[model samples]
Target chain A: MLSELDLSAIYLTLKLASLTTLTLLIISPPLAWWLARSKLFFRPFIESLVALPLVLPPTVLGFYLLLSFSPDSYFGAFWIQLTGSGLAFSFAGLLIASVIYSLPFVVQPLQSAFVNLDKNYLEVASTLGFSPIKTFYKVVFPMTLPSFIIAGALGFAHTIGEFGVVLMIGGNIPGETQVLSITLFDHVETLQYEQAHLLSISLLIFSMSLLILIYGVLQKRQKRLNDA
Target chain B: MPNNMLKFTLCKAGLFNFAAEINLAGVCGVFGDSGAGKTSLVRALIGLDEQFIGSVNFNNNVWQDDKHFVKTEHRQIGMVFQEPRLFPHLDALGNLTLAHNKRSLYTIETLAKLLDFENLLDKKTIALSGGQKQRIAIARAILTAPQLLIMDEPLSSLDAHSRALLLPFIKRLAKQIPILYITHSMQELFYLANNMLLINDGKIEAVGDPQKLFIDPRLSLVKHAHSGLLLNVTCLSWDETHAMLQGKVDGQAIYLAMDKPVEQEILQIKVESKDVIIATQQFPHSSLQNCFTSEVEQIEQISASHILLTLNLGKQKLLAKITAKSLQQLQLKVGQSVYSYIKAVSIIGEIT
Candidate 1:
């Protein structure tokens, strides 16, 4: 009865979600902090560019990444001469596209969180004898942890549901880039209704659970603040 | 105790350009209005803003000078802000230990008990009251074992009733570290300050004892009035035989037949200038019992109906408000000595 299960899609979806969440975690902090605290002339300009992914079509972004890394392109030619392999239609290329597609999901919440933080914390941190870097790590980072967690969870869930960008850049490489959403579409096109239903139910349940986790943690923090 | 000499200019308009030389051991209060540069003065002292000119030298170590600069962390100064700004992520114990420098004075449990943080250690900062948060912030600063402690209107955030509770902790803090408390309230200054710097226009207008100089309200009112000092009275015993009150004004004790009773341990009479009767020669059977021999310190007209007489009875200052017509008739001069008599009923307040 359970023979219609897509084991490969399940594995690929988990890998993509985990890798995308991990990479965004590393990339979002400094970018979010810069957007939150920087007073540079290029700050607003850079901020608008980071937010461009939010408004731009994911297919368009995926198409550009696919072209840029194709074997016939300059980036591909350069990579061929150096590493000797183009990233087009590869899992790595798909991951890069996924990062760009989910950029604002990971960053906007964190930037807002940093903005909401007490500015006096940093001032008092310096006065209390912590260096600038030490203050950021010891004070700013710890205070913004809840935001980071929520951002990571959202990015992970977003990447898990990704279909358009993965199809464009990944090209449905079985066991490699064919994530869950793409496989569910493939099952439907092939008249495999049972297979589609199984993958769809799993994706729905997984996304719901991740969202509930984020809400639960955020609510707990709010309750503690109210009680205090 | 060596005085910490610090000079700094504030290009910022609202703050002051204070050049204060003060002792660092006792509680040093920078008293002024909100925009009078109280916080700016403390911020400059602690090296939060090094852009200003001049230097700060504490115990021969210079924190800031024209050619060199030291950051706040390295300055060894502890700061407690008005809002407490407790680290919300950390519990009370963690908040207290955030700035511990691992010096000999490092005692987390001791401070927790002293600050009443025992029951609240496991509780999150969001669970604490406004006053409790401030206490934690103060404990965090103390844990650092800073050389100088700076408090910028720490009490200003609390309610009037809450301030009464915290005043004792601040008063007791004088025994531990030198505090620079910034405040605009005259009541806060009167009770809290031991040594004060009267900050006005971002400059040190006056620096001296809190009780001695706060005289006039507009300028020196704080210097004089806020002191609320003791006026030694003689012969406070009730006279049962004469069925009257007995007290002395200048030196000798006298009897009064006034109906009202002075119901407190101490009495302060606001010697209005009009009520006083000056006698050329010592009047022998006068109805006024409170008579004193005093020399005039200054004769200045305050209003059309009121002239202030600054009389000196020994070391005590006697301010009497009289009418302009009375001054013209008496021909009062600055140096002229005279015997002035006062009725016992004019005294306004009595304190136990």
Candidate 2:
């Protein structure tokens, strides 16, 4: 039911979400692991910082991201120096914003999973001659795989449904930056009711199918684990 | 030889303070009450506690000293936690092979056989019962073939039947490596410990043979109601005619109703002080199988209502806990001769 324009927006949205989720999967674990185990005085402060996006208005975060992505700002200048292009109004800028906005969704689940992990398993592994890094790879990571999957799926879904952050930083560049959420907004704004209905239905179906697939796989794994 | 021992002296900011220098030659039992620093000491020894100032020299290597801090993996130690601590994501076999050292003599199959849960190797740890998981935990630790094995109250969480099933395997493991066995239970010490260290209020109270440590009146273990004396015994012969298995304690003959033949000649027996009855005169036709005449060595008031009499039976000593009223009625006195009556079945555990 999607037109060629609508299809391009869907592809761009998937690309941004995929890139953001993959990057987050790599970046969030170490931060989440530290949050789970750190006893430093700044732990709570850092935790609140990571969780700020959960409570802050999307536009508020988008406004700050917009400022940072402006070529005049140091962060934006450094990116241009490295990549030979300004960051604002680009797909790259939207990717960065989506990552920061979806960070808590990726981190909190993994953090709690690590926190609830029984430390004795690591101790026993250590005494058995498994190095710390090896134990994490073989024991800790595998044990918490379900949580990691859930975190990744949540980050991906959150990034796909993101609008305000993408809108502010990306500035409605049709081929380069406009995503599915922005496209649907454009359709509704133009009173193209039929196109809006198709876009809305597709996004709804996509998000619901993703959640169902992830949660369904998790349930089967949990049942198998319980049975075994 | 001077540095071939586990020596550590640590002073912590709070929680626990301990210092001990002892050879890890056999089963060195760590005995203590709950929160008495037994766990803290073991954790320090294993390099799990970094908040302590200390030097731990193992086999002449500086594990933790003024200049070096070796990690637990490099220490060649295998640890069994009070809980199984198995990886929930792994099956029993996976756990056994998680850190399998190539130098290990005991295969996973062999350990599973010893633990008597061979059928469970393919099962996920989450599906196993506590006892079953603990059995796998023990087998998993053994498969690592560590230089020193530490077990912290491994049997405490297990049921009595599981404890019984596992006790023999523990005693068997003692022969394979220098073991550090930590337990608050006096009875468990008798099963595995060759030498014992008593910890109380963040200090080492005593260090000696388990039998000697148990009998030391100053130990916190003696104050407990379950306190008892452990003795080494040898099976002399089986009196098949009377369905009695004869054993000896300090060359003195004792009879027990042992239906199955004991595998080892040398065994350890725990005799609770309350189970021994004192009689002034010996009776030939008494119902009790053990009636040994012995001199009263010392007397201590255990509680307001109880008098603990230490009896010297030949070269060995036995404790008899009787009421102050019974002491008065029997007129028991130090250096006086009296018959000590121990029933044939009162010995709850016999470890070989």
Candidate 3:
């Protein structure tokens, strides 16, 4: 049912989503924790910057990323000198764009979780002789498992369904940067109704199943807490 | 002065400003009203609140001074919060092992037995009741092998039956480590705390045995509920025949019709002031078993209708709250000899 271009698009999309989700999970926790806990004067400014992707047009963000990754720019030139390849129109460039676009989806949930955490747990943990970092890993992190899962799922799904940002920054290389959304769009433009319908149905099913799984787990956890 | 005792002087602008040199040898009760900053003192003492300018020295090791401050983890202090701050993500066993120090006196097995919650070891902390969670929390704190244990109203969240159940375990644990107990409950104070520091408005108002503070008229404003005399007594003999225990306080004999034997030798007894009756002459025909001649050492009026007669029974002190009519009828005065009658069951509190 699928051609070579379609299969490559699926693989590239999955790779992008997986990499974006993994990188965001590692990068978001400390940033979110700081956003939740720090009292610095610039905290709100940093918070707004993190949340900008949530409200700003994805095309606008992608335009900025495209500009920054161009060969003419300092950062883009550094990337080229180090890696022997230009960042623009590459899978690496697409990955960076997806991460930035999906930043808030990963961060906001984790930030709220950290803010809602009972500080007495940390205090008593310290009194019980657990160091601060050990306390976070052992007690604080486990307690917020539901939020972590929700953040990860949202970030992964959002990256998979991404369109505008990739269109602006990724430049649609057939096997490298052209993801499923671009492929579906290409099928529609060429009047390939069957392929377009297939890709659309698959994306719908994937998104629906991920959402159902996340909500089901969250509801089960809520019921358990209420029963407890 | 042992080096093991904790002494601190903390100064903050608005929230807390207090200083006290505490001899942490026994259950040192931090007794105060709701806004007395007892919790702040605990936070500063444990190094949780570092904004205060102060020095906290324990075992001659400076925890906080002008130049240095030890973090909470290295302080070797265990804390039981007002609520059981147990990890909801972990089972009782897991929570206890989270901060397990290898050199501690207890393992998960022994700590479960110590707190009398062996059946709850495998249960999730969120599934446990308040009392059960508190028991696990205490065991978890003890498993860390802290040099000092700080319990901030650990029983306040529990029901009366639960309080009665967990109090003995707390009493037992106090013998192993010096505890800094913070509570407004007079029952917990009278039962658990021997040495006490009374806090008032972020200051050390008084520091002494709870017994003395209970009767000090100045404390009537704060602890009018605790109108009683505390006596140190020993269970001299247990008469299984009469279902009674022969107790001695200040070398004077006293009898208790207790169904269970007092397991410990020394017992702290509370005789309420209102329960004692004062008579100018001894009643030989009275059915009361605790009638003794005592000399009135002082007299203070506690209220418009009642007078507090402080009586010396041999070397031990006793207080009798009598009506103004009774005082007028008996014409009582200081240094006068009178008979004090207390019902056998009136020793309502006895702590080992």
Candidate 4:
């Protein structure tokens, strides 16, 4: 029911979203843990910086990212030297933008979970001869598994739905950086109403199903916790 | 210089200034009222609170000093907090398994059976009752094979029945390892503690035998209604016909009422000061069969109408609460001998 271009766009979108979610899951935990526990004077400043993407318009963030990715900028020049190519309009550039844009969605849930964790568990683990790493794996991880799930789901869903940032930096290159949202945009611009409707309905159905599955799992977990 | 001594000098500005250089054997009861920095002292001693300036040396190992500080896990100190502190995500068995090191003092099965919580092993921690949770906590602590065990008001939050059930387990553990027991209940101090450290206003008021500390006139323990002496008596014979046991304290014969015959040779009895009757001479043909001649060592006015008399009975000491009028009528004075008639003596527990 879909054209070849549409299929390719969907593939690219899935790859980007999966990679972004994985990257965020790897990096956000320690950052969120520090944000939740650190007493540094500048911790609030760092927290606000991480939360900036949540409130800022996607275009504003995309514009700055585009500037930083250009060949003339220091960051872009360094990246070009290391990767043997320019950053703008590339899949790498788009992934970097997506990860930055979706970071707060992953970090906020984890940070709140860490903050709400009962400190007595940590103390008990310490007194029981558990090292910090063992305690985190045995105690902290199991307790916050629900938060990790929510964070991963939100990050993946948010990256899948990204539009303006991908447009500003990725620039709709076929089979390279163009994703599902930009492909749908191109269809609507070319007066292809039938195709646009098909794509939109597919996206709507897929996103609704994803959200329903996530919330259903979360509700079951919450009921189990309450019953416990 | 002893290998088992625990020495500490802890000072926290605006909170407490505590210092103790004593060797605590068996159960050392840290006794104090509320807000007397008992919990603070424990937190400092165990390396939980690092804001204090102190030196804590346990079992010849330096736990904390000016330049070096050992983390709680490396200090080999097992702790049982007031709350169970069990991990809700883990079942009771899982929680116990987390503390199972190579140096564990007992196997998980042994600890579970000893603590009487084998049925609770598979249950979720949150689903367990308060007493069940505390039993699991105690088991987990012991499985760590710690050199010293510290219980910070572990039974204060339990019901009386739970406290009764757990006290014997704690007493049993004290025989194996030295314990720092923090409690506000003087009854528990007399029942379980051989050494007592009296804490008041964040300072060590006294540290010695709990029986002697109970009768220290300068301390507030003498003012408590349940203030009494814990006397160690050796059982000689059982009078099954009268449901009484004949025991000896410092070679003086004494009688105690018991519901059943006690098989233990050494029995500790709690004699409340209110239950002791002082007389100038031995009264004959009375219901009281436990009587002894003791010399008056000290007397302190407890209130306008009541006075506490410390009587020296051979090597043992006993406290008797009497009215000031009775003291004057009997003309009781230090160095004068009097007959101490124990109205009641409750068997605390068997001391191993």
Model 4 C-alpha lDDT per residue in residues A147-169, reported as the tens digit of each score: 99999999999999999999899
Q: Write the number of the candidate with greater DockQ, choosing between 2 and 4.
A: 4
lDDT per residue for candidate 1 within B149-216, as digits (tens), equals 78888877765444554565666776677777787765556556777888877787887666444544
What lDDT does the true structure give each of the candidates?
0.73, 0.83, 0.84, 0.88
Give me the runs in candidate 3 sitting further than 4 Å from their true place. A222-228, B159-161, B217-226, B232-245, B256-270, B274-285, B292-316, B321-339, B343-352
The TM-score each candidate achieves on chain A is 0.92, 0.97, 0.96, 0.96
Check candidate 3 and list the clashing pairs: none
TM-scores, all models, native as reference: 0.76, 0.85, 0.88, 0.91
lDDT of 1 by residue, A84-153 (tens): 6668877777788888888899999999999999888888888778887889888988888788888999
The candidate maximizing TM-score is 4
What docking class should model 4 receive? medium
Q: What DockQ results do all the predictions give, each relative to the true complex?
A: 0.64, 0.64, 0.71, 0.76
Error of 4 at A76 (Å): 1.5
Question: Highest lDDT: which candidate?
Answer: 4
Poorly placed runs, candidate 1 (over 4 Å)? A1-5, A70-84, B1-3, B13-19, B44-70, B104-106, B112-118, B157-169, B216-352
- Clashing residue pairs found in predicted model 2: none
Ten residues in sequence with the least summed lDDT for candidate 1 chain B: B222-231
Candidate 1 backbone overlaps, count:
22
Q: For candidate 4, give the lDDT of residue B238.
A: 85
